[model samples]
Every structure is written in structure tokens, then in C-alpha cells.
Target: MLLIEALTTGGAQRQLLNLAVQLGGRGHRVSVVVYHLADYNHRDHFRGEFERAGVPVTDVPVMAPWRRLWAVRRTVRAAGPDVVIAFLRRPGLLAELTALPARRFALIVSERTGKEGGRDMKDLTRFQLHRLADAVVANSAHLEHYVRTAAPWLRTRLRQITNSVDLDHFRPAGAPPPPHPGLRILAIGRFRPEKNFLALAAALRILRTTEPALDVTVDWYGNNFFLGQQPTGRSRPYLELLDVLRETGLEDAFRVHPPVGDVVALYQKADVLCLPSRYESLPNVVCEALACGLPVLASAVSDNDRLVRDGENGFLFDPHEPRSIAEAIRRFAALSADERAAMGRTGRRLAEELLSPATAAVRWADLVEQVVEARRAAW
Candidate 1:
């Protein structure tokens, strides 16, 4: 059984969906247990894909907190899965509570983010739950470090499994498309403050003033909404970004689009992929862009250093400093067409070596089998 908050389009959600499908394809009896389906509409939700892959999906849509726990507990007891793997915080907490006694089945909880503060109590709760889980998985070396430092008692149970991308689906284009009038840059992710979309807009404004002759355009792709968070009366982050673009008079240069399912097509059209995030465990967009042979310019945060080799496949900037981002963009713009293509090819090689979905699935299955055997040995 794989448990998560919901089947939204975030990186963690997509990764969980892919892993569930992959594990099911590997002859495992897999089912997904979601807390609610409030964030996504039917058109964009991944429930259909789960069904198509012969994986059952149980939607435990209870709104009340304790009721949600009871619902998940009931579902888990009925499913009687050999192993229950939960993604993110809420699911991890519920899975830990539901799989008490730890003797009946193995429990593994995966943490996707490395950010800290503003949730000390929540983090402490997750740490307490981590003590109950058979294993706690972190998706990057950076995230693993965060987990260990945050809850040193769980060091024995810690496991690292980097996020993966579908190489076959996100591969490079057959031939580079004809050059557009300007450089096409792409940024994809949620509109959270940590993602720093406003910083990207600020950087575009700087570039517009500094490099007047440079022809460059940025296409920002993502939705404004986030799950499980109350909306402030103030404008959302996406709207804030739009306001920044207008104030900087760079509206024409930066365009925002809602999140789309066909993201590979956007990658195919882009000359470079930029991630101006304040922090991340490891972004799926970076991996997908690299797989599609698109050079990247990401912030110097988390495990980005592991994926992007500076001056080779991609460049890193201080996400807080709009000037740094603008400078990196200028450098990428200066590269000749052939030079840019070479950099993209290097990124593709890195993706093949590090972010293949097959490799990730193998790692996950190995961990699952290890935990189950360890539990049986104890018995």
C-alpha cells in the first residue's frame, strides 16, 4: 500500500504516482490510499492512470482530523498489505499510527522536503512517528542530512533514494527546433514562496535593463494553489510574481501558464531551464530538463549541486539575489548555439547516470524487501 495526501501535480505527488505504477508493473500488489481529492480536478488528477495500470486507489476523503486517521486506519487494516509506504508528512504520520505494534507488516515513510522552521511542532511529531517506522526514506543526500540532524534517533532507520524521471518519455528531441526570435527559458513548479518565482521575475527585469539588445523570454509554468494550506487574504505568490513583472515593465518578457500535463512538450521548446528556488531536496524539473537535453540554471540549494555541474551542464546562482540569477542567464545567453547544445548533451548524460526511473524502482524494492525480511527475522 502506498499512501499520500493527494494526487496533485507536485513533484512528490508525481514521483509517488510513478513509483506506484512502476511497482505494480513489477508484479507487486499495489494500491494507493489518498487522504483527499480536493486539490485537483478530474481532468488533471492521476486516479485514472492508477486504474489503467491495474492499481486500486482508495480515496479516504474524511475532512475531520481524527476521522481522517480512523478512515486510513480502517483502510490499512482491510488491505492487509505486506508493506505500507507513505509519502510526505501527513501520510507518514497516519501510516505510523495505523501500523502500530510494527509486527504485522513493515512501514516505510518517505520525506521529500528539507525546509525547516515554521513547523517545529509538526517536525517534532514527524520525528516521534519516525521512531515507529521501520525505515524513513529521504530523497537526496541533503534531505537525508536534514532528517538525521532533525531526529538523530532515527539514524539507524534512515535511507536515501534520489527522485527519478522517466527517461524514455522526457528524452531529447530528435533535432533541435528552428531558432526562435528570442531565447526561450522555462521554469516549472508550484507557486510557493520557496520556489522564488518572484526572484525570477526580478531577474528578468534586471536583464531587460542591463542587456537591452538580448532577446530572451521566460515561460513560467505552474498553478497558484497548494493543498492543505489556508489562503491568505493577500494575493497568492503567482499573482505577486505577475505584479512584480508589471512593475518592472518586463511583462512581455515573462509569461505565466497554469500547470500542464504535457510538460515534456514545453521542455522540447525551451532553450534553457531555470529554477530560482530558495531551497529544495532535489527538484524533479531539473531531472526532467536534463533528460530532455535542456541546460539548467538553478539556485545553489540542496542537492542541485549533485545534479548540475557548474559551467558544464548547468549554472548555479544565489536564488535570493536576483542579480546572480540575471548574471547566470546572461552567461547562458552568451553561449553559441553549438556550445549550448553541448551543455545540454552533458546534462542528458548526467540524468541517465543519476535519475533513471528504473534505478529508483530497484532501490525502493530493495528497501521494501529488506524491511519485510528484517521484520520476519524478528518474528
Candidate 2:
């Protein structure tokens, strides 16, 4: 697999690492070629893990756009992979541009985002790159629909494969669950405009006023992804969100944490998981939170409606409307502990049925096998 990024901390990064290792263990020669070595917090760690597992690693330093394309072309030439899958848009474009010479290799383009997002490229590079890949992997059925509707030419190649969780690692240990206080809410993800942190803060503010001294604590743990990056408006989003907090006068109630390593424990501590993302294909955090037995309150967009059955396993609200998000929080707050636990139980059940890592690995392996066979047959 030719993944664009090597960082293991981000959602897509971690999934790529997991998929590479899992595929390697199953006797497939998996090689991950990253855009640059300087762009990761856990590079050495992922390198060591891959090395230990016998997975090949290639670091394609980002020189110029054309140079990066040449580097990808050279790497594909050297590795001679049976299948090349590019994650995210820019790299998917690069993979498409370079893989033309290596015509025997099957190219698979994967999109991790759903619909138009706050961080999505303005040029619609994803749509442009669709013609170059043999197949397209959409992380959710909702995302599949969106991509197919947007680019119907590739509808035959589209498939839905939700992000997965390692059941053994994320399952209940029979350890007594932590007792969460009243109105405790948690949201995890990079604090960016795409995540709509401002909307979440505003909703929390409304919840605070509905029941003064609601004892609500929204423990958010994530860093600004664009901090010190070339892209402008990185800090602006956080600043605007902080402005909302100050305006609502609930600045003191919010506990913003700089990104933490283990978020499974965070989900365990919270009564509810709230993801008010402006767009997403399928959020791994939502799946991880559900596996950890936390009911979700996510925006009614993309696969959220499919994953979160309103008032059943969890609730879905309009991401753009603070009132809708606030009302969902209020409803969750009104539920008894047993009722909340029941909701969480239903989410966990759904996760077990659909989002286990073993299940996802098997599905991906099957796809890889098919691609490999097709390549061999053509040869």
C-alpha cells in the first residue's frame, strides 16, 4: 500500500499503519511510502513496528510537486507492488500521475473524508483522481453514496468498508466502569474548523443555561492540526472557538487538553461522545468510542445517521445548528444512568456486529487478494 502520510497519530495515519501491519502478518508484502519524514509525531515508532513485522518502508521526501511525483514513480518502480492504494487527495493525485507508467499495478484510491469538508481541497482533486484508480474505497455507505453521486463514472468500483476497532484491545475488561458525573460530555478530534468545535462549544453553552450548575464538563483532547503550518486559519479556528466560549461565558467550564495518547480511556470516562464534524466519511473515533461502550451524539451527516439511530443507539443533530446539538445534549442529560447505559449497550452491540478490526482486516485482505490475482492474470 502506498499511503501518503506516515504519521501514526492521526485517524487515517493510524488506520494505514494498522492495515499495513495486519496485511504484512498475513504473508502479503506491504510497503508504505510516505510523503515526507518530517511530518509525523510517531515516525520512529511506526518505523520500528513495521520493521519488526517485516513490512518495508520508504520515505519519499516532499521536494517539489513534480519531484514528489517522480519520487512516487520511482518508488512504485522499485517496489513493483501488485496493488497501490493512495490515502487522501493530494497523494491520490500524485499516485494517479505516477502510476500510469506502472500500468500492471492495480491502483486503489481511498477517501477518508465525506462530502465537502472544512479542510477539503477547493479544486476537488479527489474527483479528478477518481479516473486513475481501478477501485475506490469509501469508508462508509453514506460516503459511497456521496462519491458515486458526485462522480458517477466510477460507481462500479465504489465500495463501503467502515473503519475498524481491535475488539480485544478496546473491549470491556469487566473492570468496573468509571462513574461519570451528570451532564459529562466528551468530543475528540483535532480542534479544527472542520470538526466544528465552535458549534460544539456553543451547544454546550446552551446546555449550561438550561440547567445552571449542570456540572457539565466537556473534556476535549486534541491539538490544532494546522498549528505553525503553511496553511493559514489554523489558529483562527481555535481563536474563534475560544471567542465562542468567552461569549457564552462558559470559558471556565471547558477543559481543553493537548492531544493525549490513549483516547479509549477518555471515552470510558465520559457519559456521551459528541462528534459535531462538518463532514466525514466515517470517523474512527466514533467507532472506537462505541466499542468502548459510549453512546454518541454526532451530527446528522454522512454515515452518522447510519451509525447512530436517533434516540436508539445514540442521537444525531444538525452540525451547523447549535440549537439542534444543544437539544441532543439536553436530552442525553435527562436520561437516567440506566437509560444512558442501555443506549451505550446498543452502540456497543452495533459496533461488534459491524466494526471489529478482525472483520475489517479480512475484508481488506480479500480485496487485496483479488487485486493481486487480477494483476497476476494480466501478466
User: How many steric clashes between backbone atoms does each model show?
Assistant: 0, 2
Can you write out model 1's per-residue Cα lDDT over 1-379, one digit (the tens) per residue? 9999877667887788789867876788888888872443322466666777787888887478888888899889888888999998878888989876544788999889868344387787889878888999999998888778878898999999999988898999998988877789999987778888888888877887999899989888876664434443333776777777788778888888767866898898899999998988889899899999999999998999999999999899999899999999999999999999999999999999999888889988899899989887877
What local lDDT score does residue 217 receive in model 2, on the 0 to 100 scale? 76
Stretches of model 1 off by over 4 angstroms after superposition: 37-44, 101-103, 116-121, 226-235, 377-379
* Clash list (residue pairs), candidate 1: none
Q: Which prediction has the highest TM-score against the true structure?
A: 1
TM-scores, in order shown?
0.93, 0.88
- Among all windows of ten consecutive residues in candidate 2, which has the lowest summed lDDT? 37-46
Query: What residue runs in model 2 are displaced by over 4 Å at the alpha carbon?
Result: 37-56, 117-125, 178-180, 226-233
